[model samples]
Target: MGIRSVLSKPFAAFVVREQREWEQKAPDYQHKTLKNLVSKASNTVFGNDHGFKDIRTYDDFKKQVPVRDYEALKPYVEKMLTGQNDVLWPGKPAYFAKTSGTTSGTKYIPITKESIPNHINSARNAILNYVHETGNAKFLDGKLIFLSGSPVLDQKAGVNTGRLSGIVNHHVPGYLRTNQLPSYATNCMEDWEAKVDKIVEETIDQDMTLISGIPPWVQMYFDRIVEKRQMPVKDVFKNFSLFIYGGVNFEPYRQKLFDTIGKKVDSVETYPASEGFIAFQDKQDDPGLLLLANSGIFFEFIPADEYFNETPTRLSLDQVELNTNYALIINSNAGLWGYSIGDTVKFISKDPYKLLVTGRIKHFISAFGEHVIGEEVENAMKKTLESFPEADIVEFTVAPNVTPEKGLPRHEWYIEFSKMPADITAFKSSLDSSLQKLNSYYFDLISGNILEQLHIIPVKKNAFIDYMRSIGKLGGQNKLPRLSNDRKMAEELLKYKE
Candidate 1:
């Protein structure tokens, strides 16, 4: 029942075999395999139902099928929403992982029995690869705390669909599942207020060694720990061994976390989405991440330079060039083929194919056509925060606001500060000057008068979460969208005059 049995020696051996198979595959194997898989998947799902048959080659497939975002799958999703036996997958979906996308409302993404293998394998690959790289499986031996969403299942009629957290909770190795931890089924099903209360209660007395989740949730937990104990945050997490996180860049929040904890714990960044888990940190000092290519995915990269243009060229594993940024296009086993998830990444090295996640291709502000990526804003924020080490800027968002007087646009920064700065204007000027120096395009856009005013609005510590909660989006898998691409939500959140 232990991890040793669940992830047996033979299972570990199989992972090594898979990694080798991945490395030795022919140059065009990924492309060919993906094209074939997509054809089959389309046949399995849409072809029979929709009466479309000939989906074989890449060009043929592309021509026949229109590119679809998550929203377009609503009819299929709604069918599965009833917990019907055969709407999408072969059997009833065991759980529905609730995820929010840009254009889509909250999607109850089906996590069928067939799709469970992908999730399990992805999770295993992350762990096994960590062990393979570091030669240490004991790193996860201590009490691990996952800052997950509410585990409470819906008791309301027709609301019993399983969520991603619930699925993960149900599938974890029985031996590793601790009695000290709260069960998602029992605790997460409670009312939202009660769920948070249970989480707070369970974690308060535990000797938590490893922490994982979205950065904001982790921060919230630490805040609660400090408030309850009335002790410096460092004391509570003194025994913590690792901090594993994903969903957003950790650069902006790292210093604050370190300052709060007063100790440097190993931070592992993983690339996990409701669709699939993509990659994880391969080496301790190396900035590049290692893709779990062997785990139910065949990856493709579209060169970053050509990403925005029509008919961009895609490179397979062997075809991918080194040190260049590219938009990630994944063909996962869970029915997404040649899918553009909009994430952009760059290869730092190719020996083991280590990559650095640069930004999201779709998540950008181009009011004046500057094309500001997440990395630029992240780097600018890091530099600005480093300058004011004493300031506790919890979270920040950037938006391009248009002024009607001359029909000009500008970058406005909304920051949540734990402590109010005496010299707010000076702070704004410093941030603006640093940002302008950091990104020449942004600088030119501002200087040439295309983008007008640069403003910074400071708010209370939990302002962002409070704002999201007020919109009925505080809990579950949804995150506060930073780098507000369209600025609609940003404008709404910014209306609070503080």
Candidate 2:
């Protein structure tokens, strides 16, 4: 083992031990985090507006500050963009993570000096935790490539601004900098396709070990590497073992990704967002990510079923129940108070507070009052894939076909397949049946003739890729919506129908 790997084991052990202690005391950490955030921002515009000074308890904080999505919070952000100080956070933000917004077009999420370590350290700890658990730190000696956005920042109100991934690039530690791949010049290329081509050239013959990114973009990079090397990615990077990813559910892309790599490797899934680094898969055996409760962010859970209610019940960490889906809200040091990041999660284990990202609060198909979530569809795909081993998925999305020209309106699944199922008809039946079993409402809708069985539309290869490209969201923290309530995306996808 290299010197770094030898030293890493002890450090990793220390980190793991520390993390366990905090995990057990997360409720205490969360209470303290809330108190700190409220106290620090008490003099700021948002704190004053929300009566933060009088917020003595979780109930008081909830009453004083309502849950607000990006649009709802944009006025304060606007003031900040115009060079206003202490608008949301105590001082001017150190940087702004520019993200594609839903209703607001473009969003600038603040990253304060206090909150930046939560993003950086959480990622580092995830790697260290992996090393601690598996006793495999040899990957540290090899090149680690994080397929991310350009590391270019723009000046906005005297603050550095860029994509979250790009902003993070600047903060990469010096030790890992030597082992990091895809030269800075290559990473700075804005065009994703061109950037991937350059990255393939730069790292094709390197001692690459750890590869990290959103699964789809990482798949694209693997495809390019295979095409260039004329071998599987595993063969090209024989030392490669760790695959770290976040941004979306990895289940749908799991089979295809391993197939392309030619073998299974240890992978870590994280829950890093522009808002904060919320969670990471701490245990190799557990599917749930351990919530980062002490990471400068106070969390609140609004039951997903009641999220659309006029006044959804918001519960603190101690009040959450196991196996119940909840919309995640945050009051963070970054000046976001009761901010809804749009994600929904489910607690699988409360002992150390481990949870799974179920889906998004806004991303669901409920046309006929059947709320089909991302987790259910992903689970259906995973189960169906097991039954049909030959089939491999490239990318897919689901949307409601509310105004079909034929009989009943239905859920349309636009899938781009790498290998089509041998019996497409049976595959469709199996997928639909799996989903129906997981969601009773969907099953009832189909049985009661309120909606037709889900229809699968196999689009041309790279259809989703092309669609994202057309919309200027081809790369860098842009996630394709898993499902939409409306038919806008479904209608647009028909052009690529095979």
In order, the Cα lDDT scores of the candidates are 0.67, 0.93
lDDT of 1 by residue, 1-498 (tens): 346434444565577667767645534455666555554455445445533366555556556544444666677667666554444434455567766665776666655556677776666566665556555544355566666665545521254454565567666666557632655553455354456666768766766766777777677667777778887565875667677788788887787677666778777788877767777775678777776655556677889778767677766777788867788876555555446777888887666777778778777777776777778778877777677766767788888876644456677788888755667777777777777786788789778876754788776657887787787776555566568557786767666536
Candidate 2 local lDDT, 406-484, one digit each (tens): 9898888999989999999999999989999999999999899988888999999989989999899897778899888
Regions of model 1 farther than 4 Å from truth: 1-29, 32-66, 75-95, 131-139, 152-160, 184-186, 189-194, 303-315, 322-325, 404-408, 419-426, 495-497
What lDDT would candidate 1 get against the real structure? 0.67
| Best candidate according to lDDT | 2
TM-score for candidate 2, residues paired by index:
0.99
**Clash list (residue pairs), candidate 1:** 96-162, 151-184, 151-188, 152-188, 152-189, 153-189, 409-451, 409-452
Lowest-scoring 10 consecutive residues by lDDT in candidate 2? 475-484
Model 2's C-alpha root-mean-square deviation from the true structure amounts to 0.9
Q: TM-scores across all candidates?
A: 0.84, 0.99
lDDT of 2: 0.93
Give RMSD to native, each candidate.
4.0, 0.9
Give per-residue lDDT, candidate 2, residue 474. 91
Please state the error at residue 193 of candidate 1 in Å: 5.3
Residue 458, candidate 1: alpha-carbon lDDT:
72
